[model samples]
Target: MPSGRLPVVNPWRFETNQATVQIKVGTYYSQVWTRAINAWNSKKVFTFKIVKGPAQITILPAQSNEASLIKQNFVGVAYVNHDNTKRITSVQLHLVNSLLKSNGYTTSQRVNVAEHELGHAMGLAHNPSKQSVMYKTTRYVSIQPIDVKNAKDLYSIPASQYFINLPATTSTTANKDVIANGAGDRLFKSPFETRSVQALVDPSTIY
Candidate 1:
């Protein structure tokens, strides 16, 4: 169990501290994901096993309108799908190459974004502190001590204790829509492209 105060835990999580991951991005981005995985694995609070077939977490390049996302300054996004009991079934992390390239984000910065999204997949909410990788705009940060502590603390709790009886329409039907139709809660937005927007407090921020 966590020895200190707990960080914010998302309503969903894997059954354990480890999860299978599959990366479907380009070579460069694949390396970025790999580095991100290694960074988190170094923490030893959680583990991500690489797999070829269906995986609990899938990381892929975003196929959305690049121009629109660039305009919005979004670097990446994560969608989480869970069962009725709020156990996360699958997570899809989409990295925006167009935005990353156009904005001239360095390789390390891109890796930071990947780490941030992966944190969401591990059941972490955005941290208000800018020093943590789970912050809403996390391109400038790496996984900090708070991040490791939060992840370790979250997994220490029993899965059953996290369950909440959400409305049937939102929990059941909405989740099916997410798995089948790809319409679900957008759990995280990696980083904003423009520094101006990043400076402001976003009320709808989730990652």
Candidate 2:
């Protein structure tokens, strides 16, 4: 809302200001997720609750294929799924541990990346300012006042305005991918590129 601050991914927040989360990563990385969650929770603008059963948000270590995308410099990616009404249904957050380790990211730096991905899960778009946790590329920064204000602005919107009408033939599901590059340069994949992580890293394989 402030000058130079990016807006939220409009109308993409969960039904309420809070959502259930389930972390499927290892113990060490689980702690990282917890710290990131706590940071956002401290803002009191939004809340992420850890749950055992099905959850609206699921955090996990990157799969073999997904982890391989790290070679392109992406350290994390958040895949957001929504229902026909445009309400956020579930979010799959994959933390690419392989890249983080190979790049020698410190624990705090890893938490920074987690916070960035969580921001995406909360429907916050990337802020061009490097000081915010929602920066397009993950840096050593954590959540800032601007980030909190953005979340507050998003949740403050009335529930009635959250849904947008769609065509009768619209699919029941839709997805959006938000990626974080380790290099801190361009973070999103080119739309013309193939989805295969291996092909993305090795162009020769693409036909």
Maximum-lDDT candidate: 1
lDDT against true structure, model 2: 0.69
Candidate 2 ranges beyond 4 A from true positions: 1-6, 165-207
Q: How high is each candidate's TM-score?
A: 0.77, 0.77
lDDT of 2 at 39: 90
* Candidate 1 per-residue C-alpha lDDT over 1-207 given as tens digits, one digit per residue, 9 for 90 to 100: 656576866766788999999999889899999999999999999999999988999987666564655555567777666655566767888777766776677899889988988988888877779898877776678999999989988888876676555532222322211111111223322121100111111223334
Q: Give residue 189's lDDT in candidate 2 (0 to 100).
A: 31
lDDT of 2 by residue, 91-118 (tens): 8787777767777778998898888888
Error of 1 at 97 (Å): 1.0
lDDT of 1 at 114: 86
Error of 1 at 51 (Å): 0.7
